[model samples]
Target: MKHLKIIALLLRNSLMSHLEYRFSFIMWSITSILWIMLTLISIEFIFGHVNSIAGWTKNQMLLIATVFGIFSSIMWMFFLPSAINITKLVRKGTLDFYLLKPIGNRFLLSTNQFSLDNFPRACILVLIMFGLIDSMGLKISFLSWIQFILFLLIGLGIFYNIFFTAAVTSIWFIDIFNLEDLYANILNVGRLPTHIFEGFTKLSFMFILPVMFVATFPAQILLGTADITMAITGLVILIQDLRGKSMNFLGFSH
Candidate 1:
């Protein structure tokens, strides 16, 4: 409960800060919607020439894109802003501010710069998802719905582990060269069906990049095609990172 209250306070303060700059918030909404549309267009154009890629029809592809959008907004809302910018703090030696705080540094670093704009962006994605579901006539069961949400959270955890690792690496490297680009490339793979890759490519993504579990595996769970191995792997990856990093899941150790 104490942690929850702290997170809530952080969110409230960040929202207040965002409210002070309404223009940035408005511009972000526009760009976010446009980005989603562009993603749809690119997927549709590819489908126009081929019936399906890796057995995913146009509707399935759209669903994947929607999941990707929601996940992107979630990162933007919290992780993206903080994780990407930590390099700046590392370089400037200002991380002591967070370290000196009474609370956990990991929580402070990750949630310190919450962007409220993505809240509405996530809502817009939900509306789009419902419209897509209605058009496709997908008969998702109550249990599948629950699994979808469960796996989504699981996927988010795995994603944070990978992304948090990247931020930690920045502290050591000091020249984190194209950190955002690295994450974006990995995130892009999740929007596509995992089966689309073969041999080395597939192994690299499934294990090394790990975005396959982050986005594709959860969508597969909802589609009734995901395997249990990937589920276990995701859990193990999260636990392994927590143990290896700092014996604490937050990455920074003092």
Candidate 2:
């Protein structure tokens, strides 16, 4: 309950701060929507030439793009800002302030920063997803919905762990900037169907890097073709990553 209250307070503060700069917030929203539109236009153009890519129909590809957009929005809103901020804090030697606080340093560092600008992107992506489902005539069962939600959470966990672990490495290598750009490029790959890859590339994306798990698995679940073994493998990876990172973060905090 205490942790929940802290998170609520952080969110309230973040919203209030962003509200003070209403023009900037509005400009961010406009640019974000424009970018999303351009992305969708590119996808439409691709499908205009080819009926399907890697056996994925236009609607299926759109669904994957929509899912990736949703995941990207959430990551930008909550995780990316904090991850970048941690790097800055570490570089400036101000992370000790968080360490000195009574709250857990991991919680403080991860939750202190928020990007309210991405909220609109998240909403738009969700609406797009629903429209795609309707157009595709997908009859998703309740169990599938539950499974999709679970996999989405697992995807978020996996991403957060990988991202934060990279950020935390700033403690040892302060010059390791541009991690965000590197990860962003990797995430862009998730916009396509995992079926497009073959052999080693597919194996790397499935286990080594696992960017496909971030969006592909959830989209597959919606399409009623999700691989249960793949989902279980992702969950296990997430658990192990979290376990290892928690200990590392605790050591860093002290």
Candidate 3:
């Protein structure tokens, strides 16, 4: 209960900070929208030349874009901020400040900061996704909705483990700033359906790198195209990876 209150206070303070700088906040929001629009327009240009990319229809692709946006916004909302804080805290050896606090290290690190800008963008993308789905007349069942939510949770779990592991690794490699962009780049690959790639590349993304968890599997669930066996396998592999990586991080931290 105390931790919840602390997180709530932090979120309120973060959003209020943005309101304190209205023009910059507004301009930043606008910039974000324009970039999203540009991506959509580029998709439009591509479809102008062909009926579809890979096996995905235009409406399906739009849904993929929507799913991608959800994943991206999540990164910005929680994972990005926490990973960044950990990196800086580790590098400056300022992590001890939080350690000395009453809060648990994980709790303090996870809820220390957030960018309120991402919340509105996530809501907008969700609204746009539903609107696009409506326009496309995609018939989604109740079961599919359940699957979508489940897979989304699984993806977020994978996302946290992946980026948090990277941040922990920075304790040993303090000078590398590019590790910051690593998560974002991985998320970018999720902007398209996995079917678009063939042979080894697709397998690498789906299993080895597991970028598919960030967007593809959830998108498949939303679109009612999910393969249950594959989805279950993905979740299992992620769980195993999480178990293994937790030990790896503990090994490094201690």
Candidate 4:
């Protein structure tokens, strides 16, 4: 409960800070919507020439894209700022202040910064998802909805663990400031159907980088073609990775 209160306070402060610059926030929200539209337009253009890409229908592709947009918006809202700030903190030699705090450094660092600007984008993506489902005539069961939400949550955790792991490496490589941009580029690939990849590339994305977890699996759940074994395997791998990284962070702080 104490930690929950701290998180609430952090969110309030962050929201207030963003609200202070209302014009900037509004502009950011507009830009986010434009970006999402541009992505959808590109997909539409591609489907104009091909009936289906990798056996994924136009609506299916749109669903995956929408899911990716939501995941991206959430990451930008809650994690991206902190991931970038961690690098700055490391470079400035001020990370120890967070380490000395009563709260866990990992929790503190992850929640210290938030971007409320992406909230509108997340909402828009969700609406778009519903529209896609309706147009596709998908009859998603209640169990499928539960599974979709669960996979999304798991995907968010896995993404944070992977990105946080990369960000914390700034402790050793302070000059690698472009890691966030690189990570963003990699994640953009999740907007496409994972079926487009073959053999080694598919395996690499699934297990090595696990970008598929970011959207593909959750989208699959909605499509009624989810691979439970694959999702479970990815979740297990994420748990192991998070556990190992948590130990590493603790060791570094001490």
Candidate 5:
């Protein structure tokens, strides 16, 4: 209950801060929507020439793209602004202020900068994915819906793990400006089907990059063709990262 109140307070303050600059918010919204359109165009460009890159139809790949957009938007909307920026704050000593507060540092840092403005992209992507799923006439069941919800949660966990790992990496390399870009590029690869890759490429993405689990695996599960091994590997990575002995997971511990 106390934690809930703190979250509510954080959200209220964040919303207040966002509304302080209405024009900037509007411009951001415009650019965000345009970027989504561009993303869809890029997907179309790839599918336009190739009859089928990896046996996935245009709609199937679009579905993956839509899910990726939603995942990306969620990162922007919450994870990046609030938690991922903590590294900069730490380097600047701004985090000292957070440390002095009463709330748990992790919770406060995680929720401090929730951007209501950036949520529209996620909303749009979800709607687009739903529309594509319906148009494709894929038969979905209650069990599949449950699995999809689970996959979404796990995808968010994967996002959280990646972003947190990047931020935590700042404990060692504080001036890495392209940290988010690294994550973005990895996730962008997931916009296409995993099967598009041949031999070693498939193995590399499924394990090293793990982007396939974030978008492709979830879409596959929904489409009734998920690779159980990939899904398990992603989940295991997430769990290990969360409970690992790494400095990031251990919170700057020695």
Candidate 6:
């Protein structure tokens, strides 16, 4: 309860700070809306000719885009900045500030800061996604909804572990900016459907890097293309990865 209140207070303060800079906030919101619109337009253009791209209709692709945007927004607003900076903090020995805190270290690291500026973009993406789905009269079953949520949770879990593992390694490297971008590129590969790729490329994305979790699996659920077994496998893998020890093999283990 106390922690929830603290989080609520932090969120409130952050939102208030944004409102204090009303014009900047509004401008940022408008820019994000325009960007999402342009992206949706591009997807439409690609699927305009073919009835389906790799068995996914335009609406199915839009769902994937929405899931991508939502997850990506969450990462952008919270995880990326903090994870990237943790490398510098570790190098400088300033991580002691976080370690000294009387709370869970990983949770502290995860939610120490929240960015109000990114919420507008996430909200817009969700609105667009839901609006499109609803317009199509796509009957989303309870089971499918559950699978979508489950895959989304697992996807984020995988994403966090991968990033955490990378950032922990950067404690020794010191120059991690480029490495972070490479990780982003891996996630970007899944911004579209895995069906579009063939043979080795599909296999690599699906298993080797597991970037397919970022959008592909959840998109399948939303499009009624996912089976129960696949969703269960994803959730199981995510849980196992979460429980496994994070090894900083590249960097000196701290």
Model 1 is weakest, by summed lDDT over 10 consecutive residues, at 245-254
lDDT of 1 by residue, 142-250 (tens): 9888877887786676677678778867767988487888878777778777788899898777666666755677667666777877668756765675445531544
Local accuracy of candidate 2 as per-residue lDDT tens digits, 1-254: 99889889999999999899999999999988998899889989999999999999888888999999999998889988998898899888998888889877778888989999999988998999999999889999999999988888777878887888888888888875688796798788888777899999998788778877778899999999888986687668657756677427548552
1 versus 3: better TM-score goes to: 3
Task: Please provide TM-scores, in order, for all candidate models, with all chains considered together.
Answer: 0.89, 0.95, 0.92, 0.95, 0.88, 0.85
In candidate 4, stretches whose alpha carbon ends up further than 4 angstroms from where it belongs are 246-254
- lDDT of candidate 3 over 1-254, digit per residue (tens): 98778888998999899999999888888887887788788888888899988888877888888888988887788767977788789878897797678766666777787877877778888898899889988788998888887878777877777777777777778857676678778888888788888999998887777778777788888777789998788678768767658325454331
lDDT of 6 by residue, 71-182 (tens): 8887767677667767768878888797778776665665566677888999988898789789878889998888787777777777777787777666667774676686
- C-alpha lDDT score of every prediction, in listed order: 0.77, 0.85, 0.79, 0.86, 0.75, 0.75
Off by over 4 Å in 2: 246-250
Q: What C-alpha lDDT, on a 0 to 100 scale, does residue 69 get in candidate 4?
A: 92
Candidates 3 and 4: which is better by TM-score?
4
Q: What clash pairs does model 3 have?
A: none
Better of 5 and 6 by TM-score: 5
Whichever of 1 and 6 has more TM-score, that candidate is 1
RMSD in angstroms between candidate 5 and the native structure over all alpha carbons: 2.6
Q: Give me the overall lDDT of model 4.
A: 0.86
- For 1-254, candidate 5 gives per-residue lDDT tens digits of 99888778877887788789988888988888999899789878987788666788788888888887787777777777765577778788787787678766666667777777877777888889889989999888999888877877777766676676667667668776766677677667877777878888987777666667668887987789887776886678667755543334646422
Model 4, span 70-102: residue lDDT tens: 998888889889888988998889988988898
RMSD vs true structure, all candidates: 2.4, 1.7, 2.1, 1.6, 2.6, 3.1
